[model samples]
Target: MAHAESVRVVFVDAETEEEFARTELAPGQLPDSFEYETRLDLGGESWAVVRADPPSAAQFLRSGSLVLTLRRIQTVDPQEMAYSLPTIFDPLPPTEDSTGSGEHFVIHEDDWRQAELVSRQLAGQVEAEMRAIHEVFRQSSRVVGEGASSMRVFDRIHVRRTPIDPLSTEVSLRRLSELLPVGGRPYAGVRIGDDPGRVVDSFVIAADPLVVYGQALGDRVTVLCLAPLLDAATESAAGLEQAMREFDLVLADWCSGRLLDASAVGAFLNQA
Candidate 1:
């Protein structure tokens, strides 16, 4: 898995570009169409300026439906963008490690049967943790403002409980259509979790006789299941954590740009 591209994508509704620019983060530098202000180069990737075009005014009335759009007025010089098309993959046994990017997971180098067991167990844990988060947060509210004189920060934080299901019962190419939106298909293989079951909605990542799903439509949360094919792994539960570490070993290359183009894309495209 390659690190995300440095090329910035500008998003907008099917509306006037000038009108959109006024609402942007660095109104001085970026164009709503051709270029967007880079958070690293500039200051912030202002979330305020970039928002999902509301499906309808009514959606805003009931917590807006998030529909994002990316518009390009000019092509990003792939060179200038500094993103890699190369891909790195996790190998089997002795190499797997436990490295996660928060609520994210991946599984590598495990047999299909072991992958199944790993996926199911982690799914159960995620479900239970989600339940616990909701139990503590949902249906609870607090007095936001304290003093009358001082202006409050941002009122209150009302987090809604969005209960999600297992990203997948198992992994396969056919499932990419379901994971990504139409046109959101990924071109590479992505892995998550050190153990076998972290069924996250990411791209088809490459790593030893892998069992993977494709594309995420840019979802960053990595609460995914770790799963791989059957032939390479054994049915032994005793070495679960070790297998996960072996998989984790590949992250450095992935982060540094060794994992993007590793797997032959011919296999994936054929499935699509």
Candidate 2:
């Protein structure tokens, strides 16, 4: 087996591309594994490892060290975060068609199965959370419909609630699976509203608590909430339940027409 006397890991800001820190690991202290999005602790701060210049462990063994780029966890965007596990094969290069339009990359069956497992897990979590949220509205709301991924509730008003798994949607999954891959990390969340192109509210399970209010006119969607949901970190279902309890209150107000716009939702989240 190839081995290195020492390994030097350099950390850089993902956004600024500036080196923030570097560490040298003796052969005995070398990490068992290193991969994209792996979190490292440096100076009491969390950083996500993004890239390795030599690219592989074998290369590191031959070279003894490689450059690593990392982004501060706090500065990472939720949308850019890796939601899926890494796949075994790189996407095949696009091939030109007769008309010169390139063909889409094909996903491997194993990768598809991996992504499907993640999608199912996320769907289950969403359903479970929605059920819990539904209980809060039990007195005033009645169920109109229910499915594997969504539920419809009606009080004096109607709302469709669903778990938003961008990975499960045929369109989104096909497009994003190449980027996000399939992973155990939870990236799925819930949405409550009538349509994505209209007034809607959603919560995303991210590094931070994220609640968004959205409204759309034609093809343009406008976001209303500028505040994070409650001052609490909601990375798990338990944390989400607590946030949802608070959200139910705001949703109740929205259903009653007291809070009519995204600004109201933003105010409620900021206050809470």
Tens-place lDDT digits, model 1, residues 81-192: 4212111222322223324543332443322112111233243443443343343333332233468744312112212121132233333333332332222222234434
Least accurate stretch of 10 residues (summed lDDT) in model 1?
249-258
lDDT of 2 by residue, 30-76 (tens): 44456544777778988777877776667776788778787777776
| C-alpha lDDT score of every prediction, in listed order | 0.30, 0.39
Which one wins on lDDT? Answer: 2
Give me the runs in candidate 2 sitting further than 4 Å from their true place.
Answer: 75-272
| Minimal lDDT window, size 10, model 2 | 109-118
Candidate 1 off by > 4 Å: 1-127, 138-168, 178-181, 184-272
Total backbone clashes of candidate 2, pairs 3 or more residues apart or in separate chains = 4
- TM-score per model over all chains: 0.19, 0.30
